[model samples]
Every structure is written in structure tokens, then in C-alpha cells.
Target: MKWSEISIHTTQEAVEPISNILHEAGASGVVIEDPEDLVKERTSVYGEIYQLDPNDYPEEGVIVKAYLPVTSFLGETVEEIKVGINNLITYDIDLGHNRVSISEVNEEEWATAWKKYYKPVKISEKITITPTWEDYEPVSSDEVIIELDPGMAFGTGTHPTTVMCLQAIEKYITQGDHVIDVGTGSGVLSIAAAQLGAANVEAFDLDEVAVTSARLNVKLNKVASTVTVGQNNLLEGIEGPVDVIVGNLLAEIILLFVPDAARVLKKDGYFITSGIIQGKKNDVKQSLLQAGFEIVETLEMEDWVAIIAKNSADTKEG
Candidate 1:
């Protein structure tokens, strides 16, 4: 089998949405090559970690890559991907050059090459996310290592929003807490919650591919009993008062679940929301407030924002 590597030259702001477009186009996986990884100041936690070659990254913008099957409709698929990328501009996403190119590769190369792009990334003060192939040892006894393959799922636990969400989880999750990881891509957060001592963790995603990926990761991380992965759209149909609910989702999707989140959390229970771009920060904050949540803290990393709120009282899931 052969695959076509679709590479797009774009800005960091458009990375998430564009990646989604590729996934919807039937791409097996996505790879991001951002120049910011070189000089973004990770001296504290990652500590001389990035060894990326400058030549591989564009000096000015980011490159997003994905692999799709070289099928009878390959050309049509590529054209559709281009059209989807062009559509992003209407949503105010800067595409930079938006230069897209395609190249052919063998099955072996596509299966193994992308793995080189992933490594042990120390995402937070106490968390280090390592891929399964990488041999990583804990730098400190307190350091928690999350091994993930990611596969076709979006969450690698390294995105700014995800990192902030994990940090928020570290700050708020209590022992024996029943936690719901809404939009839990790759089950990374659910695994983290279980490791952090949550007795029960429900990892939910609407996408079946993500559900399969999350379930695999949860089992691989030896948290099968502690974490349960399922398909659910945001917080819909979820019941029971959970002690903590964490979602790393788009600002619009986050808004959809804010009211439901409030209704399903116990009084004083925490809601840690991420995946919000800076532009939608106020909208999300306002929605959270309107839903009876009191914003306790706001965390920002790069151009993303994560809001930590608390449900003031117990309410039924409506």
C-alpha cells in the first residue's frame, strides 16, 4: 500500500482546525512542524529537549502534514482537503502561505516515519509525555510520564490547551473523585486523572476513531479499570454528580457543554475547560458564568485559554 503525504504551510492559529479537516478527509494521522518549538523557551521543564533541525521547519510559518491512502479517489481527496483549508479563512484563521504539496511514500515509510516527529515532551511542571517507542527515564521522582502513540486521535497531550488542562487537573483533582473527561481525545487526560488518584474516570469522545484510540491508550497505560472510554457528544446524556469534569475542546463546543457541565457537577465540583483560542476567551467565560459556574481561575498558554470554574450547587442534568 502507498500513501500520499499532504503537507500544508500555515500558521499556528490554524493548526487545530486544519488538522480536523485532514482527519475528516480520512487521513491516518497528522504531524505538526512548528518553528516555535525551537526557541519558545522551554528551559525550565523540557531543558534542552528539542533537537529539531532548523532546515526542516519553515523560518516563518508552520507545516502540517498528514497521510492518506493512495486510492482511486486520491486526487479528489486532495482537492477536497485544499477546499476545506481555503474555507478556514472565512472563520478568521490566518493561513499564511497556505501552500499545499503532495508526495508519494510507501506503506513502511508512512507507518514508521511520523514516529520520529514525536518524542518525550515535558508538558508541565510534573508531567512528561513520552511516546511508546522512546526510552525515557524520569528526571525527578515527582515527574509523571504518559506514554502515548496517538495513532489517528488528535490529543497527544502536548498541545498548549492540553498542557494547561493537565496542569489544571493536577491542581484540582482529589483522591477518589469521580471525573469525566469530556472530548477526551486519546484518553490522555483520563489516564492522567487516574494516575492522579481519581477512582473512576469516564473518557468520552463523539468520534469513534477517537474512542478506539482512547480505549487503546487507556489500556496501554494500565488504567483499564480506572478509566472507561466511550462515545458521547460533549456532555449530553451524561448523568451523576461528578467531582471534576475536564474538557479540552473548541470554544464553541465548550460553550455547548457549559450548561450541561454545570448541571452534572456536584456543588463546588470543578470544571476545567481548555482548547479555547484567545479570541473566544470572553465568550466562553461569559457562558460559563451564565450557566451558574463561578470562574475561579484562567490559564493561558500561547494563544490558548483554559478556564477553571466551580459549580455552585448540585443540579439535575437537563
Candidate 2:
């Protein structure tokens, strides 16, 4: 297998924003590591005491990495992967005084090297994610089951953005409530809503791959009928008002779609949105306000934020 390592050395404060930019720019599965975490482990005995110290540490830095499979990313020569790395400078940031570097890993290894990095991620106490190829046993009592093969789509429930949306739905979803999930990737949010007892749910994604993956995941969990998967851009071509609506999308998309969300939401319905980076929560909130939503609650996990807003009768929509 061949891989390219693109390392961005920046102050710890910029790590989250940089990661978000990279993700929005088409990088998959970004892994961020604070320089302090790389400190070497040591054991010494002083009156039965043990100690660990750093061998060598940069004053401040973080390694944000995006790993891709060789066959999918590099192929035979890996020239495309190299180009992809070079094209990753899409982020425009005033880094004070820092430089980013992209390099290639020229080596020969087995094809499945990066597969070991991914493991079953449990979204909640009752939910355990088992890859499509893996065998899993779902307890008869628990209603949660998520089977996924994250091919190229996002939101496999490992990222903070996905987790926040799932947590919000689990906290408020009631049995037999109608639910709608916009920009549903891999159908994680909708599946969780279904498992949590929403009577009927419809999930849509702009990407065809995401729609396909979401459909497979819905079937994997045996909730295909209750949860409809379709190809739509932000609820376009969908009809009717649902009891609860969830959108796991970037802050910009959330703001742009807030009015449309209000248009289809029933009076006093719930609206949950995530994929918000730091310093942008207020922007989404204001958009929601202008669209006639009353703020219910907001959640923050790591650098991602999710807002739960309620549609009130006082607001008018186009």
C-alpha cells in the first residue's frame, strides 16, 4: 500500500478549524493528535513511584492526518494521491507565523494497512457500530443497531459532528413521532432516530453515494420501511411537515436552509442541527431566529456544536 502524509503544524488553537476546513474540502477521517500526546512513556522507581516524561517535544503543534486506502487513493503509482495532497491548500488562514508541509510515504506494504485504524464505535449505551463485514449480536431488548460500510460518505458516527446529532435525537425523540433528517450521510442520524422510537423517518442526502450507503445501512438495521432514504438536497422535493427535523450539515448550509426547515416543520416541532465549528454557533442561531425558531438547547462536543430549536407559530415563512 502507498500513502501520503500531509502534516499541518499550527498552534493548538487552530487545530479544530483546520480539521473542519479539511473535512469540508474532501479529506476523509481526519485524525488529530496534540503534540503533548506523543510524549514518550517512561517508568522509574523512586520509593515505589513511577514517572513518564517527554523525549523531545515541540513547544506547540498538532498533527492532523487524513488516511486513505491505497487502491482507492493511490492506485498503482499513487500520483493522484500526491496531487490530492498538494491540492489541500484550499484553506486560507492567517497562521500568525507557521508553515504547512505535505509529503508522501514511499513504501511497499500490504493493502489493508489502514483498516486496522477503524474499530466499532458505540454511539450510545445501547448502540454499537459493527462494520458490514463484521458479525454482531444485538441484545433482544435494545432497540439500537447500526450497520455501516462508510465507503466514501461521511457521518459514520465516529466524528463529533455525527455524535452531537445522534445525542440530540436520542435525548428528545418520542415514540411514533415523525422525523426527517436532511443531509443524512450514511443514515446514522435517521437510523438512531428510528431506533429511538420515532414512528416514521425520511432521510435524504445530496450525494448519490451517501444515499446508497444510507439505504444499505437502513436495511442493515432492518428499519428500511420506517426510514425512507432518498437523494435530495436539503429537503428539496420532500413533502409534509414532520414532528422532528435533524440536519447534520456545515454552519453555512444550516443557515441557508433554516428558512426551508421552518417552512416544513409543524408548529412546536423540533429542529436539530450540527456540523458547526467554533465561533459560528451564533450565526446559526441568528438564522434560526430569523426563521422563527425558539432556541431549546445547544450542545458542544470537542469542537463541534449542535442546536435544538423549536418552531413556534409566531414566525412566518415563504
Candidate 3:
């Protein structure tokens, strides 16, 4: 079988949304190659190692790549993806170079291209994410392992936004707590919450493809009984009073449902939000404040920010 490799040269800020566009266009998997990774300082605490090659990355903006089978509708699909990415400007997202290119590869090459980008990495103190095909051994007795196959999903659970959310969930979640995971792509957060001892987890995603991918992941992690996956727009129609709520989504999307999040969480319950760029951090923080949430902690990695807020008892529930 032949596959078309679509590569987009864009800013790091646009990676999330652009990858979503590719997935919606029926890409089998997405791979991100950022030149910064070649030079960024990695912590040695987890003994993380990288074998990145300078030749594989662009000198300036990040490159997002996705693989699509050579189908009769491939041309139309690519055009639609381009249009979707351009429309992101309305949301104040930076496109950077935004140059797109395409090439052909056989099935064997396509399989190896993306898998090499993912590996077992310890994102938090106790949580480590590894691709399903990797045989990873836990470095510690209490280490939590999450095996994920990106499939048609957006991330491998190693993205900064996801890392912070998983860390926050580990810190705040009490045993047997009920967790509501908004924008639960790949269901990584939901699976982590369950592994950390959450009795019940409700994971919601607006995209049906994501919902399916997440459900499959939950089952693979043996958390299906604890984590329920469904398709829902943000927090709409979600009845909460839950112990914790976690959303790793765009700041604009996070702002849309601040009040809903506050209403859904129980008094003093936690809300963990990420997928926010540095420039929009203040906007999300202020919205959380106005919605009766007290900013508890802020986690930043590279250009991304994740906020951990607590719902105030004075905030009225819906």
C-alpha cells in the first residue's frame, strides 16, 4: 500500500490545532518534529535520553506530519485540511511559516517514520507513557505506566499540556474520587486518574474519532470499568459535583466553560487546565477567578502553561 505524507511547517502554538485538522481528515497518525528538541535541555532526574538527529528537523518553525492512504479523495482531503488550518487565525493562533508539502511512501516506511518519534518517557514523578509496541519496564516499584497507541489520536501523552494535567491529577486526586476529564484525547488523563485510584472517571471529547480512540486506550489500560468515554462538547450537559475536573485544551476553549466547570465541581474540588500558550495564560487565569476558582498553582513547560485551580465553596452549584 502507498501513503501520502503531508508535512506542514508551522509554529509550536499551532501544532495542537493543525494535528487535530489532520486527524479529522482521516490521517492514520501524526508526528511532530520540532528543532528545539534537538537542543532543549532535558532533565536527568528521570534519566531521559534522546537520539534526535538535526537532519530530521527544520531550522526554524516546527514541522507537523501526518500519513494518509493514497485514496481517490486524497486531494480534497488535503485542501480541506489547509482550509481548516487557515481558519485558526480567527482564534488568534499563530501560523508561523504555514508552508505545507507532500510526498509518497510505502507502508513499511510509513510505519517506521512515526513510531520512531515516540518512546517511553517518564512525564511525571510516578507516571510514564510508552507506546504499546515498546516493552518498557518500570524503573521504580510505584511507577505508573500508560501504554498508548496514537492511532488516529492527537498526542502520545508526553506533550507539556498532558504532562502537567497528569501531574496535577496525581497530586490532587483522592482515593475513590470521581473525575471528569474534558477534551480527553487518547483518554490518557482518564486512564491515569483511574490508575491513581479514582473510583470513577468520565472522559468527554467533542470529536467522535477522539472518543473512539480514547475508549480503546481506556480498555487497553484496563481502566474501562473505571473510566467512561463519551462524545460531548466541552462541559455541556455534564452533571458534575465531582471531585476533580481536568481539561487539556486551548485557552479559548477553556474560557468558554469556566462557569460550567465551577458549577460542576464540588466545593474545593480541583480543576486542572492546560494547552494554554504563555500569552493567553492571564486570560484563562482571570476567567477562572471570575468563575469563583482560586488559582492554586501554575505549571509551565517551554511555551505551554497548565493551571491548577480550586473551586471556591462560595461558588453556587448549578
Candidate closest to the true structure, highest TM-score: 3
Predicted candidate 3 versus true structure: per-residue lDDT over 151-263, tens digit per residue: 87543226777778888988999899999999998899999999999999999998888998999899899999999998899888887688899999989999999999988
Better of 1 and 2 by lDDT: 1
Q: All candidates: CA RMSD in angstroms?
A: 2.1, 7.6, 2.0
Query: What lDDT score is found at residue 85 in candidate 3?
Result: 98
Position 15, candidate 3: lDDT: 92
**lDDT tens digits, residues 70-113, model 2?**
45433432344334334433433224334555555544432233
Q: How many backbone clashes can be found in candidate 2?
A: 0
Q: What lDDT does model 1 reach?
A: 0.84
lDDT of each: 0.84, 0.66, 0.87
Residue range 122-193, candidate 1, lDDT tens digits: 877777888888889898988878888878843223778878888899899989999999988778899999
User: Which pairs clash (backbone N, Cα, C closer than 3 Å) in model 1?
Assistant: none
Q: How many pairs of residues collide in each model?
A: 0, 0, 0
Off by over 4 Å in 2: 1-111, 133-140, 153-157, 314-318
Clashing pairs in 2: none
